[model samples]
Target: MAKASRESGTPPVERAARASLHPVPDGRAPASAEAWALIDSARQSYIDALPIAAAVLTEQDGDLVVGASNRRYDSLDAARPASQPMPIIESPTIVRRLLEFFARPGDELRFEWRYGDQVSGRHFHACISPLAQVPGGNGRCLLTLVDRTTEIESTRSLRAELLHDSLTGLPNRTAFAEAVDEVMASNDGARHAVLLIDLSRFSRINESLGGVAGDEVIITVARRLISTLRAGDILARVGGDEFGILLRLANGPDDAPAAARRIQSVLSTPFRLARFEVGIECAIGVALVGEEQTSGEELVRNAQFSLKRAKSTGRVEIHHPGEAACARYKLDLETELRRAIDQGDLRLAYQPIVDLAANRLTGFEALARWTHATRGVIDPGEFIPVAEEAGLIVPLGRWAVDSALATLAKWDALAGSAVPLTMNVNVSAIQLARDDVPGVIAAALATHGIAGSRLTIELTESAIVQDPERTTKALQALKALDVKVAMDDFGTGYSSLSYLRRLPIDSLKIDRSFVSGMLQDRDKVAIVRAVLSLADALGKTTTAEGVETIELSQTLAALGCSHGQGYFYAAPLTADAARDYWQSQL
Candidate 1:
């Protein structure tokens, strides 16, 4: 047989191919001459059809002989002549290296190699695999060349889409959630930290700047978070204007607070969006993952709860799931609350709302009291919100209304005369939201044989503001039937002036916070004055609550606040005690 032609130089592409076709120990017999010829012919055909250069090599005595070459391969290797034999020993140093790789005994090897000194480019992922056995003693290797630059570029594009936010090109929620899950699964028992970030007053930004600017703010926030986080940490947008972060492999609980402080530092900077420079502070809730026995869902929930607690306490950040006390206290309270409402353990204590000018009892505000069969006289503050959260407020409100009406009827029959008495009952938001509230009130009034005017309904600022349009319509139906509407706990919320003007309110009760501080604080006095002025402007009356001391009562009267109710007049009394107290006063 003619000596196989040796290309003078092996390019990086050819070298990579030779490396992939390391000798294998399959122990199969070598192909016969006729079969070898057919295989070489097929290899030639495959090389010819390829878009890039290709070649085949045979290892003989630690030297590579070029068995075949495509037209592109011949063009790239200018030292080679078609159908001419060249000695491998006379070729360049790179050809020697290619021959050495094929002579080695192994299955495969892969590596990246570069070519062309001036216009050099990096080609990745050259692989080698055994093609067939050698003719006499050992198996021969078949090598093929591939240019992986295009495939690598395509892979880069896909990775960008998979890991980044489409709008801002920042790492997205998917990447963030995966990072958190991984960190939580780590074997290191050290605490991990999760930061729950919520934009304070973002609704105002959305409303004022429109959604486009709002999106820009979100993008800006994403960038800020990226800059704030370490390499292993992750940040994601969980809700509108809400972001979550996970810090992996944290040192301890001490590390979490430091991380939170660092995040705060970044967020406190001003952001310029659509020509408006707005500063945002993140309400951060930090929860230690390993210590809390937390899963992904539990960690997020605890962080959110901590964030709420932080915001309520006027802090920028808070670490929560801190102790089991908070969650346990809440659960215990919820259980007691449900039991109290269901088992008739809840009671109503009637506080006399005196007409200060006449010293006569007009009506009573039915204050909620929980006489826990075990815990005695639980404060309304302790259980009222629990009831609301448990969705028991509707039933509880109905009970209070019905009981107050019945008490009014009983006192009337015992005193042997109908004292022009109006019973004031507090209503919750859920109660007002119910479509049956009006009918419930009417039925209670009819059952007591009392006119609608004898029932004065008190609603907190939140109840009316929850859904003002629907609540106003409901209140209008109640007003049409001559039921008096009073906005209770006034001057403690937003839109108080708007509420008094829009709703068909008969009176406004100044919140005790403002009344109690009125004697010493000018701002409290000013708030009370402003409320009274607003009520007067709307042609509504005012009641001052928390008139505990004589000084507070005298000061409230001096401020032109007429109706007063508190321990100064009489502490909340039982129905029978209220009847006797009213009789004594009369």
Candidate 2:
């Protein structure tokens, strides 16, 4: 009984765990007792030349009971205990599946593993394969290890390229969304905040100094923003010249505002780019994690919503449940306005321009009007900027031109030389910059079979000042078409004499702010008189635009204003009302 007890002293696991040398899977002949010496000699010569070092393991049972490991495998986990598990560490799920593959004797397992310490994370390469020629007979697997820091860096660099902006090295929008998704998926009930930093006038810098300068500005901004945030906070370039920041661990909702303020303070310093020192203004929108928001997409949209509100109201805005409702309203309004433009719900009202010398109606300017099917009247002042921002102005301007020209054609037929009047249509800077504008006007004139002389186009100085080269070209084309061009809001801008001489404009319409206060304000009177004298010297006529009283009208006439337009004659009226007034003037 004592002999039997001594025989069974070792556990079955320990007995099964035996180590033996095996052949390398180098397309090598099987490691028979006869070939061991030859294989060992050839392997030693090339082993150091290659980056890979391989070891063979034998699995005894289905329990991942590893048999023997070669020298290469021993070095990989030299820090691990000899009794510890094989396939040392890395991506857990991948390791588990690879370990389970031992059940199939002849099957191969190929995978890469990463293992390291705190200072150097996951910087190893490993691949495993099976080479057993017989079922359950010396079942074997091969593992290879490589420690190439260059390979590690190359892989990391490729990954960074995939996820980061090429110019600024900030995470791109896709990576940013993934981060937001990760935060939301944690579901640990920790509050998070997303802040969208929108440059209010980034386009001005782009247009002024060229796109190269714009790119430098974006890179500079990204570096400054990274420095502004805590180590846990994430900054990404989510748009052209727009940045998004995520507060990874926020104490409360107020953390978002404090972060924004710090960033704003940092940006208060000017960015020196090449030859120019530039300062930029930014509008910030913030959204905080709460019970109501459940997804990253929702959080991003809420931040964008806050951004729009901030831009509109000129302040930093935070997302509230009410903000969503307001966003829905704004989106609804934008969609309806688009449809209103396309479906002809937009129309024009005509206001008279009278000749002060003859005291007769000379022409009428067309002003845009819109009425909602459910909401009654919408003011132009409220919606015009919206139209401009949406790029709906070009289409809107075209429609207005067609409508005014068609009405003028009918009016000309009715008047029949008794009270022929010109038609004036307003054009926006968006339309002026377009190469198609002159073609549109030419088509409208042809469609109505009307003379271009009967059409007068009005433009503000701001419209002409931007993109002067393009503006001058469009004006030259209009003059070629024989249409009169009037610079509206003349004295309100810094209009250079050289600018006026460069274009073929016909008249100046003095801004009402000056005209309305001219009687009581000497500075206003001087501006009016100076504008009138300048127009005369330039051989261009002057139209006093806000003659609300008879005294103002007579004063404008005494100041040698060529025409007068405003409530002194009449407010803007309907087309039929305008027609009747022109008929009565005859």
lDDT of 2 by residue, 1-586 (tens): 0010111123333433321143345645444543544444453344444556554444443333333344554465565433344345323543464456655545565555545443354455556676644332545565556666578778877987988988887899989999998988987425678999988678999999889889988888888898888867889999997899988645677788889898888777888877788998789999988766778988899999899888898778898876666666767778889999888888899999999887888999999998999988988986787888778888999999999998888776776742478899999987777537889999999998888888999998988888788888888899999999999999777767888887898999999999996899999999999999989998998898888999988888888999999997999989999998887888
lDDT of 2 at 530: 93
In candidate 2 the C-alpha lDDT for residue 318 amounts to 91
TM-score of 2: 0.61
Best by TM-score: 2
Error in Å for residue 35 of model 1: 45
Cα lDDT of candidate 2 equals: 0.78
Candidates' C-alpha lDDT: 0.73, 0.78
Candidate 1, 92-196: lDDT as tens digits: 433544555566746665555433322334343444456666433334454445666567667877986887767776566667666666666766524567788
- Segments in model 2 whose C-alpha atoms lie over 4 Å from true places: 1-172, 178-193, 196-226, 237-242, 248-330
> Candidate 1 — which residues are off by over 4 angstroms?
1-187, 197-244, 249-284, 289-301, 307-316, 321-324, 434-436, 496-498, 517-537, 551-559
User: What residue pairs are clashing in model 1?
Assistant: 20-128, 20-129, 21-128, 21-129, 134-139, 134-140
Task: Name the best candidate (by lDDT).
Answer: 2
Q: After TM-score superposition, what is the CA distance of residue 65 in candidate 1 from its true location, in Å?
A: 46
